[model samples]
Target: MSSDAPVGARPPAGKTFFGHPRALSTLFLTEMWERFSFYGMRAILVLYLTAAVADGGLDLGESSANAVYGTYNAMVYLMALPGGWVADRLIGARRSVLWGGVVIAAGHYVMAIPTGWSVFAGMALIVLGTGLLKPNISTMVGDLYERDSPRRDAGFSIFYMGINLGAFIAPLITGFLGERINWHLGFGAAAVGMTFGVLQYVLGRRNLGDAGARPADPLLGADRRRALTRIGVATVILLAVLLVLLVAGWFTVDTVVNLLTVVTVLVTVGYFARILTDREISGTERSRMKAYVWLFLFAASFWLIYDQAGSVLNIFAADRTDRSLGGFTFPASWLQSVNPILIIIGAPLAAALWLKLGHRVSTPTKFAVGLVLNGLSFVLMAAAAQAAVGGDLVSPLWLVAVYAIQVAGELSLSPVGLSATTKLAPVKYASQMLGLWFLATAVGDAIGGQVARLADTWSQPVYFLTFGLASVVLGLAAVMFTRQIRHLMAGIH
Candidate 1:
């Protein structure tokens, strides 16, 4: 994408961003900073909310805090649908990415102020900013490489590391400031992170020449005005409904959770129906769509379980897991770093294992195995819960091992799912299919919020064991039907 170079020329002959294009350095650093800000805030949001008001918190209570946290996560992903649409149509991904960074930085600064109401404003801005930035920035990463370029996978792997790196370090930096020093300081740190990202991106973007500089489908002037008008009407209708609910005294945490759950189900069903009924697809494409539906089911199930790491598991780490290291106690948010650390260590090993086994295994078989591993992680957690006899503190290794194993499950299914989506989706609906993939995560996350509520109602053993059994049963079912699903894939493997 370098503007100064001739077409097809490689990034300047000198040092590259880890042997890839120089454009990668810009996008990589930008994403790293964005993720740092995002995860840093999430690390302590619930804790800050539940703390006493005198301690610089809103005192929202545990249930309410969890509700807000879960809903915020769900909304972040949900907004991506429209964000991607906007980037693809009205605005180029390039400008959208830049403006989104500004919005996200503003959001962080908003949270840094010392006021309770500021939290809502901050979250709203962050959600909107993230929706605009997250997916589009990722799209830019692919622009750094040419189609069939051998360096493409390696470039992405490097980009993936940047993501985990930010996630790994965010809690460490913000958790200390937010939990130990001051809450606003923590948020301010996140603001600083984004500021750094934005400044660097402004300086380095020339390497990414025309990549994402133009919208794939640009809108006409009247069409743009009509789109804005429709958006305005939708926003008014949404606000009116919320106002009515508030006036009726029905705007509670449970209400939001329940509403999102129903909405998620509707969205999931609608996506599947849209693809299956598309008359433009060939017979083979239709069969592959069926396979994709099955893939969505398994992917959603894994996400429902995996998404708990940042929510329910976070709470458990704070309240139940012992954070002491021989008289020195650490921040509970430190535990969030474990999975990324595991990913850093395990990603290469997992990739190697897959490469070695590729000739011997099928993608569906690998997915089924991933599902089974996810089930086992829960089973281990269930046992850990059972072993908390007489309220004794369980070893931190219990949580560590569970997180480690969950990463294994993620490695097995997640990358395969991404590849499969591109391979199996009808060409006409390429980007939509990717959006649908993101939607699966949103649905899982919304349902996860509902499931997290059970922490208050059910015994630990009961909750863990039940979910564990469900996961295992689902995995077994996937295993049994692997061949059927693979057949539907119609040579995609």
Candidate 2:
């Protein structure tokens, strides 16, 4: 799928905005609006559920709310596997993203109806839509560059900025609408944001050109057909097993959650094992791949905490923080902007730090540092929880502090981890490798949702403390293992 055309391969021959192509602007705005819809809806979901039944919520208990939240977050990430596959094998990335946006917009609109089943259905559609949009958009960014282009990292950074910008603004807009008028109104606002993104993508289709091209059909030849048959057989066997488990009363929601977690972990481990066992892999490559696996686990742990921005953090801000400013109490939904707002402020400083220290530290080392920073953010949150003891309002500054620190950790780790993944992936399985990375995040977010649901009758302080200690311990352990990883990444960069 290498393009002979030089259209988006270079910097568009001679444009002058940071020396990048204008198509970057189109993609940036599109991603911004998409994230606006996502983060905005996420900001209100838990609050809506737990908001007294008198206030029109289904009034789900803590565990149930958290369970649903976990399942929804987890499934969103899982669906990305099929989403990426469809983009690679069926429709191109552009089309997949466009259709995905439509699906998500509908989901949000359904959510605005304020019904129980509609909430479930809306969440499902949003999950599926995100699965379609998230992976394809990033892949399209990579497509904007030719192989070995230096601008790729910078382009991704710019794109990441778009993510924060949307995330930063979404809470302010939707949170206000939700808390002040009706929660459904906020959901409606998110739908409007997604609608704008879909329209932008349509208008900018020419700018995208053939960035997301479909691969040749794998079912065309007999050899491919046989391979596909084996895959289908395996799928059938797995489904049959699941059905048996459900009938046997072993497939409760908890069981399904555990099963999904186990299956995803096993598959990821198997992929790594295969790579390591293969004699074809050079020793250096093996070392680096091992490092990549460690980074994966580290990232998984970090997100297990970080993804709480939606579930746990939302409740904390709503219940504990002093939303009162002068005469009026601010909407709790506005607190959802904390993470993204911090990212917007801190990302530039972070980008500058990387540039300054690029030669001093390896990517794996940066990841190690990032995990520690992320762990520290939780510690700060625990302190906030401690301060909020005995039903008194704690300062919102504590929340702000936690967000700032976590954003720092995100800057250090996320992009670098993705960069490392690309470098270490075997050439033949590049797309699959990226899929696995995204999948790990899905697993982590699902776990975060579960953690978020623990607020019912549990002391929120204890929860934050437990999570904080766990993250710090894991971060330190990852740092201790950094030498081996450094050896792995020695030649890749």
Candidate 3:
């Protein structure tokens, strides 16, 4: 009903691209540029934080840097709750995407301004921007395809590849600029990427016009006006309260920030459960949503270990690994590119492997395999930690191997989960459902950051081994529940 077409009707011809709507390209490039900005900033984030005070960093100790890392990563996902809600109820996906791009561009530009407050302001803006863009973009992709279209999975796969392509290359360019020249230059480059995305989207509006139309209502303009009025008042009150809290200092910076984060997560989860209980969602749809919850748990577990590429692993590369190769010093920031590079190489092969085995294996079973593989990546990391403790430089091969394994794990679950979201989600609350999917990732990353902090408390080997063991246990338990979860997917395929 939200679509441009009448119920059960089809679009006109000449809009097809590789078996999907041509608009997929517009969405693809839009996501590509957005991710380029995001990952470009991500590549330099830890290095910027952990750099010595003389080099323009805050001179924060390892603990402070990792804590900020955790908090920042958590907030990126947390913001998606309101982002999804705003798109569903008011702005629609097109406007939300545009607004998110503007905010992100401004955030990156703010980081280029060169001040301590600029860093805080930039981070807040990026968090809000990502929440707005990330979920809405993917939901728009699903909207381009009709329900039960076989091309839907492949479309998501293609879109996901665009994400990796941006992620893979951004770090190499931005990381080099940040490390070799100026950190702000790298941030400036990210701003340019976002700006380009925004411009492309506005120019290509016709291609995406059908993808994010406002929902139709019998009351028409009256309904629209009432909704806008309500949202405007809510926004004004929320901003005023936040400004007051900041002035009063009744909440310390960290406490108030994290408290707002907790409130966001709880409210989002409650909304999704309410949807699950609604009469509009059929019994099969509820079962599939429940299955999604399990998949969410599985994903959260993987990210808990996987997100360390930025924090704990960044530390390992900087402090323990020898960057020397003959007379050349490898830039520490460049090391962040390893996982994305591996994703580029391994994602295709993993997809092929899944295609070969998909008929024989269920999705939950494949997800279990992904968890086990992810755990093994950390087992290798633990071995690297052991080598470091003994004063031996870890072979770069160990890092490459770990990255390869993690990418393999990612390929197993990431595309499957994206496709499952579209299949399982009821058409009415499509963006909201995907928002919950992303919220799971946010929760996972937050918990992972906390777990990554264990490296600061105990020995690195203990931290690594504990995560590995937890993955193995959770993976097996997930495998045990596969039959029940698969029952939920009965009508979806």
* 1-493: candidate 3 lDDT, tens digit per residue: 1222223333323576677787888788889999899889887887787788778776656665675777688788878877776776667667888889999999999998877677778988998888888877876776776766777778877887788778877887888788778888888888998899889888877876466654222224788688778879988998888888778886454455466546646765786678788998777778787888788889878877888787888778777888888988776666777877777677778778878876687778878988998999898898889989967777666777888888888888876776677678876776456566666677777666556656878888888888887897888888999888888876554
Using TM-score as the measure, the top candidate is 1
Candidate 2, 253-366: lDDT as tens digits: 567666766665666677678877888767766777777777888888788888776777777888888888998898887877888877777778887888887767877677
Clashing pairs in 1: 1-209
The residue ranges of model 2 lying beyond 4 angstroms of the native Cα positions read: 1-19, 148-151, 216-263, 277-280, 453-458
Model 3 spans with C-alpha error above 4 angstroms: 1-25, 139-155, 206-226, 233-237, 240-253, 279-284, 390-392, 426-431, 487-493
Query: Per-residue lDDT tens digits of candidate 1, residues 154-203?
Result: 98899889899999999999998998888889999999999999999999
Cα-based lDDT for every prediction: 0.82, 0.76, 0.76
Clashing pairs in 3: none
TM-score of each: 0.93, 0.87, 0.87
For model 2 the local lDDT of residue 259 reads: 70
